[model samples]
Target: MTDLIKIMQQRQSCRSFSEKPVEAEKIVSCINAACLAPSACNTQPYHFYIAHAPEAVAVAAEYCKGEKVNKWVGEAKAFVLITQEHAEIPAANSEARKRDYRQYDIGLMIENFCLEATELGLGTCILGVFNEEKLKANFRIPSPKSIALVIAIGYPADSEIRKKHRKPLEEMITYLR
Candidate 1:
């Protein structure tokens, strides 16, 4: 199998992380990969902020709503906040279509970052249940965009916990003429 396929198969949402800190250069590489993701009309409106401070991670953990997430997020060595700006859509465009495409663009960027992190032997989890308003206030995100997602990064604590099960390809695939 190709390296990309191997990376995809091995990638999993890691909740337990070791105390080892991720290298700054590695994090930057992941973010660079994310920035190269394709976007609708090439309007890459996403912005990313990386927080490596322990105090900042603690603050973000407090604002996270998930109990399981709070336990793990608090220990993460770094946090990445992804945001997207609100753009005006042409009157001729369908609202649903515009929304769908923008969301797709965001998903692509997130996946790229995740895969890059995996390649770097780092663990990451995409978090959605965060207090957006509080994060903006605490993180001082300037106006023009809103949080899309947050990713917690660190080294996996245990290999067993890193193993992830996936649905069978046959079950997920739909063959159509």
Candidate 2:
């Protein structure tokens, strides 16, 4: 548990990235680690589209830029587009089928991905302010599939780990026991 906590502490949303390109193997490792995340009914309703080539990364970066958000993604050496896929039975045929678990699954996978990247000395920033339509069209994503998030990945220009702030556990959670 402490090991995981350390990784979490080291992981931060990096906005300043160096021009050095991220290794393909490192990206693959992140994806593989993400697949280890448990999903509802074993339905991993997500796909990661990697863009590392200069042209591809440029296009993805352009789509990720918003008026006042994610403008720093342009310097990332690679981008990963997390796309939401169809979840036939999100509840595993249980009675609580109304609640879709795809979003939760995606969140778990993304956390795993980020943790793995941090362990590998890479930096990542998750971006949610992208032009989904442009990304879908440019990346050849089929209709009905939606881009849930975009992650900028590369070596951090500043290697120092920043402090993380969060609500205390007593305020954020309650134990029924």
Candidate 3:
């Protein structure tokens, strides 16, 4: 199998991490991959705030909903807070289109980021359960738009977790007559 295929297969949500720090270059590479993701009309409205500092991570932990899960997030060596600027979309676009487009674009960017991190032998988990208001206030996010997601990144701890099974192609695919 190709390296890409292997990376995809091996990718999993890692909740535990070692105390070791992830290199700056690797984080930049992951962000670069995110930037390369396809966006609606090339708007590229996403902005990422990397929180590797102990203080910032602590703030993130406070906003996180799950105690055990977020404690692990706090311990993570690195995290990226993905936010989108709603005003970045042109006024000419419909409100519905703008709302939907921003989310779709951010999701694409996150997937690209995770894939790149996996390829670099890093472990990551996309975290959604967080206090948005607190995060925005703590992070000084100027925009009134939604803070889409937060991804925790670090080296995985030793453990035996089973791979999540996926539906077979035969069950998911359909041929049009």
Candidate 4:
């Protein structure tokens, strides 16, 4: 397997984090990696609002709560609100295949960020159970737009990357001849 494949297999959603702040330079580098991910016509329509300040991180964490599984997000030292803009590919490109392009683009950018963070020895968890409406209001975000994902990142305070249980290739794949 390739280095990227190894990285992908190693990445895990970290639930416990330490008080140690993620170095600013490393955070910037990871975000840069995300920006380099492919998008529709290179539209790069995703926006990442990073919250490193204690107060800001607190606010972001608040909106990420409301569920038992995500309560740990509050303890994270850094939070990123991943916002995706509505897709507006050029009119001439209207023939493009249908699907929510913005959502797909966001997924690529987020995986890039997580892979970079893992390579940097930082831990991350992609959070989706947050209250999007409240989160938007807290950030003064207008309604009707998409907030694709919220990610928690920091130094790990808990266990190492444990074994992941997954289906084997045969069960999940089909070889078409």
Top-scoring candidate (lDDT): 2
Question: In candidate 4, which residue ranges exceed 4 Å CA deviation?
Answer: 97-99
Question: How well is each residue in 18-47 modelled by candidate 4, as lDDT tens digits?
Answer: 888888788888899999999987788878
- lDDT preference between candidates 1 and 2, better one: 2
* Candidate 4 least-lDDT 10 residues: 91-100
TM-score of each: 0.84, 0.94, 0.85, 0.91
Top candidate (TM-score): 2
What is the C-alpha local distance difference test score of each model?
Answer: 0.81, 0.92, 0.81, 0.85
Candidate 3 residue 9 Cα shift, in angstroms, is 0.8
lDDT for residue 5 in candidate 3, whole number 0-100: 76
Alpha-carbon shift of residue 66 in model 3 (angstroms)? 2.7
| Candidates sorted on TM-score, descending | 2, 4, 3, 1
lDDT of residue 87 for candidate 3 = 34
Backbone clashes in candidate 1 total: 0
Worst 10 residues of 3 by lDDT: 87-96
Count the clashes in each prediction: 0, 0, 0, 0
